[model samples]
Every structure is written in structure tokens, then in C-alpha cells.
Target: MQFRPTLWPTLITIPALVVLVMFGWWQVQRLQWKTELIQELEIRGAGPAIPLLVDARISAEDLMFRRVTVTGHYMHEAEMHLLNRVRDGIPGINVFTPLVRANGGGALLVNRGWVPIDWPGTSIEDHDVEPVIVEVTGVVRIPDPPGWLTPGNEPEKNAWYFIDLAGMSAAAGVLPFTDYYVFATGEKNLAGEPVPWLAPDPNEWRVDLPNNHLTYAITWFSLAGVLFIIYVIYHTRRRGPDDG
Candidate 1:
């Protein structure tokens, strides 16, 4: 079989093929990186809780999802609410309060847990007349960057769609706050008593990291294959008429 390729088709097809293949390869690399991250997080979650060093310079990757103990007094006046959180098909918000470390380390935001949207008090002070100093065990959490579609947080109104450490700190007047926050472990407070809100069990609260790179990679490669087949057929038909 004679293969006569036209100049126009060859030029167009070669660059298009190169671009498609490159995209597919990049997705494969992303798949591997994501898999390793999930595995490391699981191992950290299973270990014993360690004391959080407020002054220590820890990378976000190293601190994320690690169970740690922090002793502090809850700053009820500085509490903030994260909107649009749901549990058991009910809409609610996650309550975040700054914990002023007992050791004078620094103020660390603590995600106390989820509360009903209609829950009367925005801060713990509304419920407790006096402040309480306690030690709590919880899981460290790093805030994810807001997506393009996510609405901007309103600090003046105390409305939050996502976690913004810097913004929250400034709004609450708690400067020099820790970069990461902690999710309290049980539905009850440190005293083993029931609280108004629900807390997540760190052991059961597995990370829901999405991994769709494999599917994306297949689509790009398929498109490249289809393009190659069309190019060959077009050239072959043109040669057939000349031969006859």
C-alpha cells in the first residue's frame, strides 16, 4: 500500500497530536501524587495524638489531619461561623473559636463542630456565663483555597463560606494566629459532657480527596487516536482517484 501524505494535513495533525499526548501524560503524574498524599494522611490520623507546638514552623502538608492536643481557654467573643455545612441532610454551620494557648504559644482557631443554622447563640458566651479553661484533643486541618465559583467571605457581616485564617484572625482581633485549625473529636466537650453541637470523630472523618485524573487522561488519548485515523483516511481516498 502506498501512503501519500498531503502537506497541509501533516502539519496540522502533528502539532495537534503532540498537544493531546502531553496533556494525557501530565494527568498521569498528578494521579500518582494524589494517591501518595491520601496514604500519608491515613497513617497520621491513626497515630496517637501529639501536643501542638504553636511556635514551631511546620509545613501545612506535615500538619494536615494530624491528631494533636491543645490546652487553652476558648475566646467566645471571637467565635466565627462557617456557613453551608450539613449533617444528616440538615443544613448547619461549623463554629470556629480561637483558643488562646495556656502556655502563651499563640491563638489557634478551633473548629468546635457543627451547629444548626438557627442555633440561637453565635458564640459560646451566649450559652456559658463564665469562661472555661480546658485541654482538648482534636485533628489538625488546613484550609483549602476558595474555588473560582465560591463567593467571597464577608468579614464585616461574620459570614464565611470557607476557612480564611488571616481574615478570621483580623475580624476577631486575634492577631498572629496559627495557620491551621483543629476539629474537636467528640460530640461532647473535654469534660465528657454533652454539648449543643455535633463534633466529628477524627478516626471516622476520612479525607475526601477527589482523584479523576485517570478518566481525564483516557479522554485526551482517545481524541488523539481519532484524529490520526481521520488523517489517514483523507489521504488514502485522494491517492485512490489518481491511481485509477
Candidate 2:
């Protein structure tokens, strides 16, 4: 009777091979997702802006991120500055004010634009610039999720940057607003103080799929091949002497 210990190299190699295959598969899946997302954004960007609320009717209201146009009166009373935004390398504030539809019915919060950080507790003087009815065109986008580090809309304390649509509506004594608001793109009213009309830059959104999976797959398969070759050589050389 004879007993022999299993070769530790082959035993460890099996698990390493399995892990490499799984990692490669995961990266392939990620590449596919990125490709699909880029295609969708391109398609959406090509369409014409929806002009009226009725024209863009649909389920689930946060149409933020979609290009849209609306005319309304700027509700100066409900205006608040979203804190801690940066512009040109300086700490700044984002101005957000409610826009009451000119024809009446509902109000939408407009993210006017960013302003350089001012005194810690001072509000931007609205009267310094008179209110004027204006037309705004821009893409709709949902507010950043709570706890995303953007200043939350706080009317009572007069501090805010992120436009929490639902919260803004509640604070304005208007229940329920569109789940999203327009990022004003052109023809902003009352310019200078509160610069509006900013389109989101998409450089960061481009898909950059990596080809490392093939490299990894090759590495694993190569190692497996080397192991098999060594095993054969070792057994063949040893058995040659045994055969004699």
C-alpha cells in the first residue's frame, strides 16, 4: 500500500483560475452598461424641447434633466441661495427661486445660477434688482439626493443650493411640484446678480470601457497552460528513469 501527497501548486492554481474568469466576466458586463447609457443620452439630446406641460405629459413627475421651456413670474419671496457651490475656483452660492406660471396653476423652482460666496449670513438683496417676468429654457433634472453634500433648501433660515422639489413646494405652501426643475439654459431674466441658463457639461459622462479583461483572461489562461506543461515535463522526466 502507498500514499502520496497532492501537488500543492495544482490545487492552488484551480481557485486562482476561477477567480480570474469571474473578474473578467464582471468587467464585460460593466462595459455593456456604459455603452447602453451613452446611447440613451445621445438619443434624448437630439429631440426637440417639449414646449408645454400638456405636450410632455407622462407618469412620474421628476422630468429634471430633460430639455424644456416654460414662462413664469419669478417668485422673489420664495428665493433662497443654495450654499457652498464653486465658481471659477472660488466658494459660491447657487440661487434658486420659485417660478409661478404666468397663466397660473403651479410653481416650479428654477436654479438661476451661481454667485460668488458673500458674507456668511447675508441674503442676496432682491430689491437691488427689480423682478421681471421672463421666459426660461433649459433641461430638467432631479435634485441631488439628500445628504449629497449640496446645501438643502431651507427657506426659514434662508440657506439652500439643492432644490428639493417636494420640500420646496411644501415650504412655499404649494403641495407637490414637478419632481424636477429646469436648469435654465437661455434668456434668463434679471441677469448679472443671479446668472441663469447653464447647460450641464457632459465630458464626465463619456464611456471609457477598459480592455483589461482580455489581458486578464490571457494571463490566467497562460498560467494554466504553463502549469500543464510543467506537470507533463516533470512526470515525463521522472517516469523515464522509472521505465529503465
lDDT of each: 0.78, 0.60
> Which pairs clash in model 2?
64-140, 64-141, 65-140, 65-141, 82-160, 82-161, 184-197
* Number of colliding residue pairs in model 2: 7
Number of the predicted model whose TM-score against the real structure is largest: 1
The sequence of per-residue lDDT tens digits that candidate 1 reaches over residues 68-117 is 89886777777788998877797888888888888888788888877778
Error of 1 at 61 (Å): 1.9
Q: Name the Cα RMSD for model 1.
A: 3.1
Q: Model 1 compared with the native: what TM-score? A: 0.85
Candidate 2 at 212: error in angstroms? 14
Candidate 1, residue 221: how far the Cα is off, in Å: 0.9
TM-score of every candidate: 0.85, 0.61
> Highest lDDT among the candidates is held by which one?
1
Error of 1 at 8 (Å): 2.6
